[model samples]
Target: MAKGSRADHSARLAAFSAGIRATRGGKSLDINATKLLVAITQADDADRLADELVAKGFRLTRLKTHGGFLRRENAAALIATTEDRLPAALAIIRQTCRARTVTWVPPFPDGIGGIGPAPMEIEVGGAVVFTIPIEGVELLGGDVAESLARTRAAGGAQ
Candidate 1:
């Protein structure tokens, strides 16, 4: 098949699978039992952490964000997993997001008379993780979903 045609066929197949995965017997599918929102302030650590999680068979959705007193670049990783695998996910995050010291300079106000911007060393680069109990999760049209379903069907240990 031509490359374009093959791509088109793949797209259609994915859409069809997504429709099927959305509902089963008119009911939504719930696959995940736990949800983790991990905000990693250190941009440098984001990719490494994400790769490590994927390597460990964990799925993550990354969102680019900027915040904190310094307006630093951040990556927020959304992880959905079973309750039994929550600890493993946390461990990957903890191991990858290491704390380190960074120099920060405070900008002086324009109206200030004599004070100038002062640079100070501060601790930074850590992962802020929040674990929330998810009532349900719906995974649609992807290898991850298929693998998860097969695991559940086989009563695989999480």
Candidate 2:
């Protein structure tokens, strides 16, 4: 092939590949718009959900959290993706983070003759998702030395 035609062929091939990938429902191609999906789920579900999201080409950060309702440890999945991929990400969350009922005992005050309230069946083990349209995002990296020092200090405190 002639030099000019070879360049043209390469450009066309790139475009064609991109089109095919887009049609195949790969990760969102739209990079201009960003969405943040904050999913607070049961700790057990969070690990699996985060893994699945990553496997599906969604970027996410997993965090250990505490929930107000139970004051129990939970997992928070912070997903940053584009609108095109939002629905698929949500479907994965819905399928993985299923809600179930658990028995919870209510804590009574000290005046209650030292007996606690009856255990009640409460809905739990589900996920709460908040979708936020992100205007912009900035990542501030931390210094390695500083992080190491902080970690050492935390360990000393512990």
RMSD of 2: 15.5
Model 2: residues with Cα > 4 Å off, grouped in runs: 1-33, 142-158
Which residue window of length 10 is worst by lDDT in model 1? Answer: 12-21
Itemize residue pairs with steric clashes in candidate 2.
none
* Tens-digit lDDT track of model 2 for 1-158: 46456444443223222111111122222123367899999887987898888788676789999867888789989886667878999999999999888889887887668567899999888788999987643323433223323433444211
Clashing pairs in 1: none
Give me the candidate number with maximum TM-score: 1
| Candidate 1 off by > 4 Å | 1-25, 113-115, 138-158
lDDT, candidate 2, residue 116? 75
RMSD (Cα, Å) of model 1 = 7.1
For candidate 1, give the lDDT of residue 41: 44
